[model samples]
Target chain A: MPEQLVFAMEVTLNGLMAGVLYALVALGFVLIYKASGIFNYAQGVMALFAAMTLVGIMNGQVPFAHLINAIFGTHVHEFGWSVPGFVAILLTLAVMVLLAWAVQRFVMRHLVGQEPIILFMATIGLAFFLEGVADLMWGSEIKTLDVGLPQGINLWIDETTFQIFDYGFFIDNLDIVATLIAALLVIALVAFSQYTKQGRAMRAVADDHQAALSVGISLNFIWVMVWSVAGFVALVAGIMWGTKSGVQFSLSLIALKALPVLMLGGFTSIPGAIVGGLIIGVGEKLFEFALGPALGGATENWFAYVLALIFLVFRPQGLFGEKIIERV
Target chain B: MLDAAQTTDVQAETLLEVNNIEVIYNHVILVLKGVSLTVPKGGITALLGGNGAGKTTTLKAVSNLLHSERGEVTKGSIRYRGESIHASDPADLVEKGVIQVMEGRHCFEHLTVEENLLTGAYTRKDGNAAIQQDLDLVYNYFPRLKERRRSQAGYTSGGEQQMVAMGRALMSRPETILLDEPSMGLAPQLVEEIFGIVKDLNEKEGVSFLLAEQNTNVALRFAHYGYILESGRVVMDGPAAELRENPDVKEFYLGMSDEGRKSFRDVRSYRRRKRWL
Candidate 1:
């Protein structure tokens, strides 16, 4: 292979891995939107909150520590004993589940049968509320998360590529893990949705609320279940992103990247999220590599949005979204 | 109001009773004004009305589906098997052997025909074998649904979608189905076919029906008893055979009269001459 071709292949490979992470975030949005009509604006902050909660649990930091310390002048922070990585992850998941129930009970329950736009506006309000709550619960401090996931370049890949093409391929172990995890997550989600009884009810509810209700499917329960699943996805995305870059307020901004992915993939699709993430990921990276120098570099930042904008005009349903079927 | 003469003929046990119900939407607009009806077990009762006559509202009120649309039964009580169900959840109503096949054939559009039917059995604690037996029963009633079993409900024809909706309600093993507008947007032949199935289900399966229909002609032929709703109130109630012969019904609804095919101009003055008013 030519050296330029090998370099392009590496960039594409990196982009694909990055796309998996984007798909991870997009999965959260898709899950909530699929089960309920609400487009959860709080999805990014959910990832941030889950990651912060995981970190706080692992470090044994007191929740609402700043307020507690300020109010009491007690200066008590950590419990002085860190939880194991697995245990912390489990604890964070439980908290996320609790959060899901609370969201459905307190916010979504009262807003049932409201207009979709109104539900969407509620999510925007929820986003700010959750963000404030997360900040208050886990003080606004950047924290490095180490969940035992492997990171850095794989030497085996480097050596194998060097031997095969006279050039070493750069591949991060973390990205490799993310790709594997994402593949498994997609498979699990597909299986759960395709075969399980609850999964069928969830899809039924997604299709028509009144019909689903008529069939005796509890909408509130399904909403909480979907939110919990989305919360779990957010936790996974949080773990991956928190490991890549320390857990911080900026961690939530990755959801903005997912917006283009969803726009390209369609809001009501799961496979679309994954495929859309990959397309945006590889397209942006390849675009920057091919045209960055000519365009004064940094084309990667705006490439996905431009491509998504073009997709919106032609095929608003995305690649795998269910086409709107209207009859006279 | 149901008189002793009307109630005396239907000696079968009452499956559902909606008493002098008043439905208000958004807490302001009164939609159902003191409507009352009865669904006798093993019988088909039709709630007949034109558009905006509160046919759907009366059915929703029975199935407790009014809450979702911001409509509430502000005054009356709905009872199923002698239990007050007006305030219960729609899901609970299904558990108590009642389900509503919503107007406009609200089949889960994304789901395949078979999957849509399976959703009907969501509340069933019975195993898959029993549910599958009922599934076969539904397919028997709607063999066309079996042929299009794998196809998406959204892509099916209007008549087939209506069948799918009715079949879905059947899968729930409902004792009383609050069917709303089953004949809407379907051909006359298909409408007759659906009514045939409803009659079969009522006779063989022993499922009671409180169906709302705008096709008064077909409804009167199929229903054992009927209620004529006009402007949110039941103006008349009688046996279907009697209702079909009633002069006012023959003129206004059946589009015929003793004078023979009265013109629209003459029927315009019906409100003043209507005996029930």
Candidate 2:
């Protein structure tokens, strides 16, 4: 087998792993967008905050200790013990929920019915505010997340022999776990939106705010519910990415990649976000593999944007977006 | 003016009273100038007017869609069931059994026919069984909706969408349904069909109706009471049958003379010629 083919296979595998992470972040965006028409640009920062909070809590940070003392008013350090992985995950989810509820009540509720662009800009401000808050509370330092996800590459098939067969493939167990988690989250979100009463109310609010109000669905309640749901999703994405590459400000940049995924998938479609993430992931990897040397290397930086720009020109309604019909 | 004794006799069965309500849009333009009318309970009331005669604005004010910031009832008040609902929210109005089937038949285009109907029961504090029963009732009234239960509303025809909109309002189980131009932009035959359904819904279900329409003949024929609005003011008010016979209303609105028809045709053709240029 040729060295070129091995390089291509490696890049493809790597790209797909990154894409799964992108899809996770995009899922958070879709949840907020569907429940509220506002584009939540603060999603990246939310992920950062959730991850930072998780690390702070796990490491016996003073502010996390102070927050616990203030709320439960019990002086505690590092939860006084080490909990199981699942228990820690559940505890982190509770914190995310409280954070989401606070943001919606204090920030988003007052900004209701404003222009979408204004809301989008407000989220940008929120992102910066949250980043500063996280930095203040936890101190701006990269931390290692130990949620007990398996580490190190476990290559099932030998690359050298597979390369000899001229059809080489390398698969990592961690990458496979990420793919499975991404798939599970997508299924859960779709089911929640379709089968749950609150989910239906969210969709109704997304379609028409006035109509939703007329039907006695409380807009504020739905907003809080969706924000919390999105926050939970961000926590999951943060954990996955943080575990894979360590928790830091760079994880926030990974969340930013969701913007182009949203552009390609259409902000309203959940499945579109997942598929768009996969496409961006695989496409960027292949592009970097095929054209990296020609473009002086590292074409992956702008590949998602280029693909999204091309899609916008041709299929602006996106993969699963409803076609808008103008009536006189 | 009718004597106070006669007005009291008329007001005894009134369900809705709009008393000298002056609505100003943007605190600048007075859209409804001292508009007043009475809609008797358990009967159809026709608010006859041409375009921009403040008919739609009056309906919106009653529904509480008009905010004081954008538009306000500057002078008077609106009473539903003898209680002033001047500053009530639209959702509160629905809860209180007053629902509006808006002018444009604002159906949720993305939802299926059944889903749209389910939305109408949003305010009801009933179990699934009751909602299902009401859903069945709506289907019985508009069988076409039942036939297309799984179809998205965007694919439905204008007439069918109108039925869906009406059915959605009916699902709310309102005591009084305010319909704004149910006949707008429909075929003549479809318009008659819709009007027939409205009459049936009113008589069979005991739902009172206050309809605003430009088509005077159809409205006057079905309504029991009528208020003729000219330039945001009620110019004439009487029983529907009597107003149908009034000479001025007949000449200007309902029963146009042959010469008036000729002038109407001449104006239409002149507009067509201008479009050709």
Candidate 3:
């Protein structure tokens, strides 16, 4: 293969990996959005919080220790004990589930029947609240998360491809792991929603709340269950992203990237989330590699949004969204 | 022909009883006022009315879908199998074998027809064998649904969507179904076809139905018992045969008087002759 061709292929491969991550974040949004019609702006922040909690648990950090010390002028940070990564993950999952329940019970329950835009704005408020709370609980400093996932380039892939040509496709083991995990998550979610009873209920709730209720599906229970699922998806996203760039405040900003993904894929579709993420991911990467230098570099920053905005004006229902047919 | 005020036949084996119910929407505007009806075990009962006459509201009240629209049963009680179900969750109703096919055929537009049927079975704890059997059974009744089982409900015709809704309710193994506007937005032939399937389901499956409809002629033709609703009140209740022959029902609802088609000039007499105030 030619050097430029190989390089482009490498960029495309990496873009696909990045797209998987974006889909992971968007899956959280889709879960909550499809089930409750709530555009959860706090999804990214929730990921940040989950990542921070995982790190804090693994390191045995005290909750709100920084705030306590700053206020009382006393130092009390670590608990002097380290928890196993696996144990910390389970504990963090429990916390996320609890947070989901609380959010649904307190914040969402009262806002039933509100307009979608209002609910969306409420999620923005939730994002700020969650960010502030997460910061207070585990301080805003960056923390490296080691969840035992493989790191660095896979030389085997590079060496084998290089044997056939010049410059073997360089690929990160983390990206491969993230890709495998993302595929598994999407498959599992698809199967769950398609084959399982609760999954069918979730889809039905997403379709029509009143109809689902008429068939004897609990609206409140479905809402809480979806939020919990969203939380779990957020945790998986956090783990992958945290491994790439540490757990920090910016971890939540990935939600911003995923919004365009949701728009391109349609907010209600899981497969669309994956496919849309891949498109944006590859498109942005290829654009940056081939055209970024000529266009002032860093075109990846706005490429996905511009693509989604243009896509929306032409096809508002999105790639897999139900056709928005209106009747008088 | 009897007067509209006449109440006839209260069966001892009634499965659902909506007794003197008054439904208020948004906590203020009253919709169903002192409306009472019953669904006998294994019988088709039609609640007939015109548009905005509270037929759908009455069904929603029975199915507990009222809260979603800010409507509630402010007066009287609804007893299902002799138990007060006013405060029960809608999901629990399905568990108890009561399902409502909503007005306008609220099929999950994004889902395949088969998937929509599966959703009706969500509350069922039966094994896959039975569920699959029921699925095939639904297919037997709604063969068009079987042909388009993989098609998205949104793309199907209105008649198909209505069949999907009914087929979905059947999958739950429901004892009673509250069918709202099964004839809406369909050809008269399709309406007759769907009602024929409903009749078959009732006869073979022993599923009781309380269908709310504005198609007075069709509803009364298929139902064993009929209630004529006007402005949220049940103005008349009688056996189907009696109501079909009632002069007032013919002139006012079925669009026919004793002299064939009643012209607009007889509208004042028809209004005066409506004995129920």
Choose the strongest candidate by DockQ.
1
- Tell me the spans in candidate 1 whose CA falls farther than 4 Å from its real position: B1-9, B272-275
> What is each model's TM-score for chain A?
0.99, 0.89, 0.96
Query: Worst 10-residue stretch by lDDT in candidate 2 chain A?
Result: A76-85
For candidate 3, give the lDDT of residue A40.
Answer: 91
For all the predictions, what are the DockQ values?
A: 0.84, 0.31, 0.58
lDDT of 1 by residue, B230-253 (tens): 989999998988898898899889
> Per-candidate TM vs. native?
0.97, 0.85, 0.91
Residue B30 alpha-carbon offset, candidate 1, angstroms: 0.8
Task: Please report the candidate that would top TM-score against the real structure.
Answer: 1
Question: How would you encode candidate 2's per-residue C-alpha lDDT over A1-328 as one tens digit per residue?
Answer: 5778777777777788878889899989999988788889889888888888877767656654556666897966554555566776777789888888888888877665567898888888988988888877777778889877776665455465465655546666667788889899889889988776677778877877666665556677888889889999899888888887788987778766998898888888999998888889989989988988899988888988988888899999778777775565
- By TM-score, the candidates rank as 1, 3, 2
Position A100, candidate 3: lDDT: 89
Summing lDDT over every window of 10 consecutive residues in candidate 3 chain A, give the lowest-scoring window. Answer: A319-328
